[model samples]
Target: MKKKITLLFISFFILASCSNDEDSSIIPVAPVAPTAIHAVLNEGSVDITWTGVEGAGITYNVYRNAVKINKAPLTEAKFTDVLKNTGSFVYTVTANLDGAESTKGVVSEKVILELPKTKTMQSIDIYYDTKYEYAYTYDTSNITKLVSLTIKETNTDLTYKKVTVTNTVVKYTYAGNLITKMSYYSVDDIPRSSVENVYNAQKKMIGRIVKRSDGSINYTVTYKYNEDGTITETNDARDSGVGIYTFGKGNLVKYSITTPMREDEYLAVSNYVFDTKNEPTLNILGFNFFVNNSKNNEISSSTVITLNGELSSTESSKSDNTYNENGYVLTTMKTLKVSSGETLQTRQTVITYY
Candidate 1:
């Protein structure tokens, strides 16, 4: 009668142990890259937008041509960049999360710069008596921007015009209606030299500075206005002397330039006669830097160079011009002469509009 009781045995397996300590080897989640980046140009300004990752402690940064242009991190997904130059730019945006920045995405956009034209001068072509030619191009979209100046040593025939820019000079730059800089370009289109204009309180140009590509000053010229409405240009070079400029009715009637010689200083005085009509070159941007642009069309000129107060050489020029519908000079046939009234050459100029 002993108890034949049989006990059933059951076992439970524990998958995890209950503990108060937490996992210390856990890894953090990284920031996600931005997407759908876009850039738009609005009147010389760039507006950049992107889709950013949603997270805490998030920020954004803007890059232009791979250079960080943003002064500080942005919390929004949009940015506006005011451009000071006219050229193509590469734009990209980055996202930051929890003090960490995501690796830069391959997504990037490019924008070609554009500006509005404010003047009417378009292009000009000059044909010299020696078969040399010069063709100046303005911006196709913005005519006020002087694009490039092409010179052909002997290509006025228009037969073998090539795209060789090895012998070109500086391009024009402006600030509003005033042209401020001329950056000389070398064979590779690199600015190897430059000329800058300084203005006074009334926005009158008072000084001109020339510098080499190495940022060294070559020379400086200061312009002083006189009570009699004349201008005195003083050059800061040992070999150079003061230039006396006499203007009449917004035109340079007489100009004298002193240049250094091996033995004595040479003084060249140029006198001009003008017609009572607007000159086409006056409409051109940055053309007055050489003092060739006159409010009225220049019809005749005489130059006499003296060495040590003695006559050295004499020259003269007269232009036979045809006018346009607006009374602007459309074409000019210039006849140049020597001291003995001998005809040296005849040159031609043609202007075209957009």
Candidate 2:
């Protein structure tokens, strides 16, 4: 009875297993392909927010008059066309995910921003100065702290330090306020540092920066000038980011550039330096990386430096610069430390300009 049951059941079990295997082998059909893309500008540029490609790590191409203007991978979802006098422009984004890419989405937008009026300065002058007074407790320690400061003009020369400190007194002097030919003095009345600088009448920078061991930094910028005194290029070596500057529009605009890291990095970090007041005189940045449960950003690892100012030799104070509405520096504010001691007070000097 058992043998008969086994033989009869074997065939049925085999057929059932085959049927299950066949069912498992059948794959579901893939979804339909994505639709073709057509991009158009909702405002002045293409707005890709409505499409599924928003912030999708997509690659895009911008075109004007059916000719490609830009083809680059976008870090953001938005892109602007700053090309001058683009009559008609179209922007399209292509969604690239995995190995497959979606069809191009296109948009056309019109832009109209009125350019501003320009001017040529007949003559421009910029300068500033600062003085410091220090008071120190000789019995406690040799450290001296600045108690008071006075601002002065760059043209005026500082004679002596009026404050008395424990053992040290510092004085500052000026040959010129151009930031390249300034001078400083010590307690013994010995000249310690000298700074040098060069600029055009508009104060556009074009020079090299040199720091000597005697505590002096010099600036000598070179510019390509027209016979009429209009500038072509203004280059400065004191900049950590910007290197070469190409001028346009009758000295109204400047292109400050950082020396290219590899000649290729120039394309992205290269930006326009407009002659507007919104331009920054200093920029200090830092970046860090961390691993697994550890905070990555660092603080002490970075050294800070001023972008467009002269430094004092003894205390390393950055000089102040004053700007007008036309974006030119009109005056400079500088401070010099004198002396600090237990018995004597500090002295300050203030200067005015025409």
Candidate 3:
């Protein structure tokens, strides 16, 4: 951290004699500097505060790396730089008077910019069932790599005899630039199943192997790319299923799954509509490596189920969102409904980036 100290400057008022050569009584006005300028990292932004210059009619002007960043002389000794990129930064502040900026003092602080690493998804179910929280650990040595993730879940239903809490931790293993596996464990130290990825000689992932806690094979999924650019997934487990994923404009637009339901095979189809804005959670490093809702913010989605090719049930959901200037989602209001038009529940989520 660097501090820019404003040195006291005395502007001498030159006393000049009139034609009579008599000295005019005059005094010099000294300009005061702010005590210090402090820039601290806060929630992926820079918070800058400076000790006020003790005087009336004096304001403050903030500078970043010698460039004035504020549009007007600030009445207060504080400024917040909402950063859009990361790098080393220097901040300075000086008092202002009569449209003139005072000299900046000599304390300097260097701030290293960090990528918006953490996103807290604080969600409240309008229907009150569960709450979810997640935090990710960044490999500080190489910040682009996400090392681990922790998830906290709470049972919010008061009808339950007692509420329960569960904690899950996920760790990632990578091979070069590709993510190879993700392992899961409980906070209490209980181990869970792990999923391993299978890649072809071309470094393209072709399948995934799920393993039991004891290292035995649980199930496997194979992937195939279609000529039309859609992808198909075959699951050897889970009632022997097949799924097709359709993509559009860098997002998954539709998905359909076929699985045996009792004696007949049922088909579940889902469709999604996305906004052009970038998804907020996807800003986290290494998150885009997963096959999921990462490319764009989801606006609306629907799912339909058919038993033996006959219509069964249908449901749809929509999201309303507010975003920061960088186009990252800051808040989302979600609503869900059934085919009968009965509202299921509403959910609100606020995301903070750190």
Candidate 4:
């Protein structure tokens, strides 16, 4: 009886030992912390990445500024945090395994502020050859208003003859961001000519009046718009002629001018072909402006005009524009087909940003 009892005890001890060994083998080990955490700053966001933990069923938890940001563990090794404003931030990542969290791996970054969507032009410098130039100045406090324009002339020859500098200064006034009046002056400070512009409630130009310095109206031009947001007609008081305009595909395709009494007498006619991305604005001139209107800033165009019902002229032009790192137009070169049957360099414009 004593031998049988001893044998039962030994069997029970062996069974208990085997059960403890199996439980020890099944116990999970905590995962190691992620290493080599890296952070990259982007416009209004931050991108973070780290070396993945080596184990089965492991995930990652992301923390920003020592606070847990993600509610659940991520299955991948990368994360992107969108910032509400421009500022500095810190991030850390930890490896998670079977409800166990490891130590964190850390990184820091700064979210740069985005620039304003629109910046009004502050100044313009026009180079009419090397000897003559026009420098336009604006009130930067109100970028929509141009204050003054000065014409400068350079003389390289040392001669006793006096250089006649006329119409050297011009003053401008604005009403609600629109040019309301402009007055030109000679070098002696005497007024030369003045122009007045009138606009409707929709900010569309309604009338333009040119006057001599003596305040006598020299000529007047009035404009009317169609329902589709295009200029339908213009009346010129100087020549007693009216111009009719027709548009196709949101572009001004043709225009013809005629006197009121003579319906068959067409003074002039012009037809234009625009690029796919043209936004016609009177603020700038040339087909290059149409191409510059594109997001890519590249364009080519052809135009034809008639005088007295005859094909008077044809022109072809192209423009190439380059941009700065901030996506602003840095420089542009325009080439035109001249009467000499060869391409001539017409204009070059450079822009500076604040």
Off-target runs (Cα >4 Å) in candidate 1 are 1-166, 262-265, 285-292
Q: Which ranking of candidates, highest TM-score first?
A: 3, 1, 4, 2
- The regions of model 3 sitting more than 4 angstroms off are 1-128, 201-203, 281-286
Name the lDDT value of residue 26 in candidate 1.
Answer: 42
TM-score of 4: 0.47
lDDT of each: 0.69, 0.34, 0.74, 0.60
What is candidate 4's lDDT per residue for 169-228, written digit by digit as tens?
778776645667779887678898998877778766677788998999988877777776
Tens digit per residue, CA lDDT, model 3, 91-189: 888887755667885444776553444444444444456666777676655545668878888777655546678899888887765678888899866
Q: Per-residue lDDT tens digits of candidate 2, residues 158-244?
A: 344233222233232222222333344444546554434445566434443444536655444455545654444443543334333
Candidate 2 ranges with C-alpha deviation above 4 Å: 1-180, 184-193, 198-209, 215-220, 226-252, 268-354
lDDT of 1: 0.69
Which candidate number would show the highest TM-score if scored against the true structure? Answer: 3
Q: Per lDDT, what order, best first?
A: 3, 1, 4, 2
